[model samples]
Target: MESVSKIRLWILQEGRSIRSVARATGLSRNTIKKYLKDDNPPSYQRQAPPARHKLCDGFDTRLQELFEQDQKRPRRERRTAVRLYEQLVSEGYTGSYSPVQRFVRDLKRTDAGSGEAFIPLHFAAGDALQFDWSEERVVLGGVEQKVKVAHFRLCHSRKPFVVAYPGESQEMVLDAFVRALSFYGGVPRRVIIDNPKTMVTYVSRSKDRVFHPRFLALMNHYVMEPVACTPASGWEKGQVENQVQFLRGRLFVPMPAFDDLDGLNDWLRLPCEELANRAHPEYSARTIAEVFEDERAELRPLGRAFDGYVEKTVRVRSTCLVQYASNRYSVPSRFAGQHVSLRAYAGRIVLVSGQDVIAEHKRRFTRNVSYFEPWHYVPLLDRKPGALRNGAPFVDWQLPDGSLSSAMPR
Candidate 1:
C-alpha cells in the first residue's frame, strides 16, 4: 500500500516517469503504471472465513441457563466455572475446561453489569468522619491473642485515631467513638460507618437504615447524625478502610508487645500523633495535624463525655465475687450473696451498690480468672483464721514484714 501510494504520488505530483518511479520504489513498471492510473491506492481487505465447528458448539444454551440459574442462588451456592465444566463433562460434553471457562466469562461480561463507576467525594472541615474495625494479632502479657482494632478518620483532614479492643461488641463500638471524639477534642457533624451489626439493626431494600438503640442513643448524645453506607459498599466509608490497612501495616506489624491492652493503646498515642504530624497527602502545604487543628474549630464543641460502659446487675457469689461474662470479680465480703451493678469499662470493671463503688478491678479477658482483693476478705479471715491455710483465694496471700502470717498455726 505504501509503495503504490508513493509511486502514484511520484508520477502524478512530482511529474516523474513511471519507469523511474518503479526503479526508485523497487516495483515493476506495470505495477507503477497501474497505481498512477488508479485514483485510489490499492489495499488488501481481510475476508472473513466460513463458520467453523466448536467443541462446545451446542452447549451455549445449557451454559447460559446454568449461569442464569446461578444468579438466583446465594453467592456461596453458585457454581464456579470449573465446577460447571466438570458437570458438563459428566453430561457427555466432550470439550476442554478452557472453552467452558471462556464461555462463562463472555456470558458474565455481557450479562452482568460491566463495571461500577464511583464519583469522587469531598467534605468540609468537621463535616463528616468515618469509622471501621479490623482484626489484628498481637502479643499481650507474653501470650498471643487476637484483638479488634477500631479505626476512625476525619474525612477532610485524613487524620486518624486507632485503638485496640478485646471484642467488637456494641459497648466497644460506642467506647471507640467516644475515645476518638475525646482524642480529637470535638465531634464532626456527621458520622459515617458501614452496616455492621453493632450500629445497624436493619437495612431496608430502599437503603433506609435502622440503627441499633444504643448506637442511636450515642448519636443523640453527641448531636451528630449517623449515616450508614450501603451494605457491601465499603467505598462509601473508604477513608477509614484505608486507615485500617495503614495502621495494620505500620503499627500492628511485627506484632506489638505490651503488658495489657491499656499499655498498648497508650503506646499507640505517640505514633498516632506522629502520623498526624506528617505531611498531608492531598494538602501538601500543611501537615495533617495542622489541618486537624483547623478542623477542630469548625467541629462541635467537646461537651460532657458519654458514659460508654456496659452495665449489668449480677449476684455476688458466696465468695464475695460478682460474675460478669465468664469471669468473677471480688467485692467486699459484706456484699456477698447480694446483687450489685457491674459496669464494664474499656480497661476496668467497677462494682457499685447503693450509689457507692464497692469494688474496682482491671478487666479480665480470660475466663474463670478471679480477681481477689485480699483486703476484701480481711474481716472474713479474722473470723475464720484457720481456714486461710486451705482457702483457694488465699493460696498466694502474703503478709508484710511486721505482720504475722494468718495461715501459720497459732
Candidate 2:
C-alpha cells in the first residue's frame, strides 16, 4: 500500500519520473505508470481467503469446556484469556496464544446474560430498600483522609439517606442500617444488598446465601427480609448504586471538611432532607419528600431499635481489661479473669455480664491503647487501699470541684 501511494506521490506531486519511483519502490516502471494513470488509488484484492491453521483444530471442545466453567465462577475470580492460554500450555497445547485468545474472546460473546438488554424493574411502595458503600476523600480533623460512606435508598420513593464512617466493617455495616432506618423512621418489607461478605457470609452455586448471623438478627428484629444481589449485578439494587454516585458528586464534589465524622454527618443530614424537596424522578408532579410521606404509611412502624452490634466473648485479664482490635478496655474488677460478652458498636464498646452493662466507653481505633472507666476500678479499692493513688487507671481521674460536689447525693 505504501509503495502504491509513493508511486503516485513521486510521479504526480513531486514531479519525479515514473522510472525513479519504480527504482526506489522496487516496482516495474510499467506498474508505476499504471498507478499514476489511474484516477483512483489502486486497491489490493485478495486472491483467496487466508489459509486456516490446525493449531486450534482439536481444541474447540476443550475451549468450550473451559469457557463454561469460567462462566460459573465469580466474575472477578474467572480466568482471563492470558490465564486460559497458560492453562492450555500446561495441557500440552503446542499452538501460539493468539488463537486461544481470539477463541476465548469470541466464546464470551455467546455466553448467557452476555446481551446488553436489561429489564426495567418496578417496586411497590415500601417494598424494599437498597444499600451500598462508597469511599470518599475529605478533610477530617485537619487531615485529608478517605472515609467509607454508606448509602441507602428507598426503592419506591427514591428517598436517599447517607452516613459517613471512618471505615467499613461488619459492625459499621450494622450501625449504618440502624442509622438509616432511624432516619427514615421505619423499615421496608425487604432490603436489597450487594454481596458484601460483611453481611452475606456465603453465596452458593445459585442465588442462595447464608446471611451473617448478626446481620440476620438485625433483619429479624425489624421484621424485614434480606435479599442479596447476585455477584456483579448492580442493577439488582440500582437505586442505591445510583445514589452512591449522585451523592458523591452532590456532597463531596468540592471535597468537604469537618472537625469530626459526627459534624460531617450532621451537615449531611440537612442536605438529605433538602434533596428530598426536589421532584421525584418517576413522579415528577410530586417531590421526593412528598412521595416519601406517602411511603411512610406503607412502611412498617418503627419498632424498638435493634441493638446493632458485633458481639464477641473475651476473657478479662488480671488487669481488669478485655482486649479488642489490639486495644483493651477495663471491665469491673469483679469480672477480671472471667469470660464476659464484648459488644462492639460503631462508636462505642460495652462489656455486658448477664444483662448488666458493667462497662462502656467511647470506642477507640488506635491499637494497643487501654481505655479505663475510673469507676470500674472502684470495687477493687477494698482489696488494696493504696492502689488508687498508684493505679494507672486512675491517673487521669480527678475529684469534682466543691460547687459540683455539693449537688451530688451523700
Candidate 3:
C-alpha cells in the first residue's frame, strides 16, 4: 500500500500522471487524482502478522486434547496453555503456544456454546476478600499430621491471615475469620468466598450463592457484605496467595512443632502479627498495618455474638452416647434413654435439654475418651466388664473381670 503523500509526491514532483500513479499504487485513478489534488495521505500498514510456525505439527490433535482436558477438569485445576505446551514439548511436541493457544481458545468457544468470553476483573480497595484453604503437614515431636490452614486476604492492602486447623468446618472457618479480622484490624466491606459447604448451602437457582445459616448469621453480625466467588476461580481471592506462600515458607519451614494446637497457636499469634506489621518490600514506603488502618475504620462494628455453634441432630446409639464427629460424647444418665440435641463448638459441646443445656463437656478429639458423671455407665460396667474395659481405654474399672466391686466410679 502506498501512502497518499507518496502518490502526491510522485504526481507533483516526479511528474507522474494520475493514471500512471493509480497503476503503480493500486489505487483507483480517481482516488489517486483526488489525493494528488488534496495533498492528503492515507494510512499505511506498518507491520504484518508474525511468521507462522514451521515446526508445529499435529496441531489439531493437540488442541483437541487440550480442550478435552479443560472440559474434564475444573477451571482452577485446568492446565493452562503454557503448562500444556510445556507438557507437550516434553512429550515430543515442538510446537510454540501462539497457534496452539489460539486453536485451543477457539475450541473453548465451541465447547461453551454460550458466547461468553472469560473476562478479567479489576478489584478495588475494600471491595472483596477471597478465602481458601491449603494443607500443610507439620511434624511435632515425631507425630505427623496433615494440617489444613484457613487463608484469608484483603484485596486492597494485599494483607492476609492464615491459621492451622484440623478441618474446614463452619466452626473452624468462623474462628479463622474472627482471628483474621483481628489480625487485619478490620474486615473488607465485602468478603468473596468459594463454595465451601461451611458457608455456601446449595448453588442458588439463578446460579447465585446460597450461604449457610451460620455463615449468614456471622455476616449479619459483622454488617459486612458477603460475595461468593465463581465456583472455580481461585484467583478471585488471591490476596491469600502470597500469604499462603509466606506462611508456609516462613512459619511452617523446618517443620512446625508443638504439643498441641493451643500451645502452637499461642506461639504463632505474635509472629504472624509481626509479619503483618512488617513493611512490604514492594511498597516499602508504607506497612500493611498503615493500609489496614484505613480499611479497619471503614468496617462496621460486629453486632450480637454468634449464637453458639452445634452440629446437626445426631442419635444416641445403643451405648447411650451421642456421637459427634468421631468422638462419642455422653449426656446425663437420665437423658441416655432419650435422644438429645448436641451443641458443639470449637472447644466445647453442650447437651441441650429443651431450651436449657442439661450437660456440657469440653469436646474431646480422636482416640480420646470423655465421660460425664460416670454414674451413667454403672449398669453397663456391671453387665459386661470386658465391654467396659474396651469402651473406656483411659479409665480404670477398679474391679477384676470376674468380680464386680461396689467401688465408687471415678
User: Candidate 1, TM-score vs. the true structure?
Assistant: 0.67
The whole-model C-alpha lDDT of candidate 1 against the native structure comes to 0.83
- lDDT digits (tens) for residues 4-103 of candidate 2: 7766777778899876776787888787777777757677799998875544646767877887887886443456676777778888888888888777
lDDT for 160 in candidate 3 is: 66
Sort all candidates by lDDT, best to worst.
Answer: 2, 1, 3
Per-residue lDDT of 248-311 in model 3, one digit per residue for the tens? 6466654678887776677767775676687854568888778767666665565445554745
Q: List the candidates' TM-scores in order.
A: 0.67, 0.67, 0.61
lDDT of 1 by residue, 160-232 (tens): 8888899998778889999999999998999998888889999998999999988898999999999998778
Total clashing pairs in model 2: 0
| Candidate 1 vs candidate 3, TM-score winner | 1
- Model 1: how far residue 108 lies from native, Å: 22
State the RMSD for candidate 2: 17.9
Clashes of 1: 0
Worst 10 residues of 1 by lDDT: 401-410
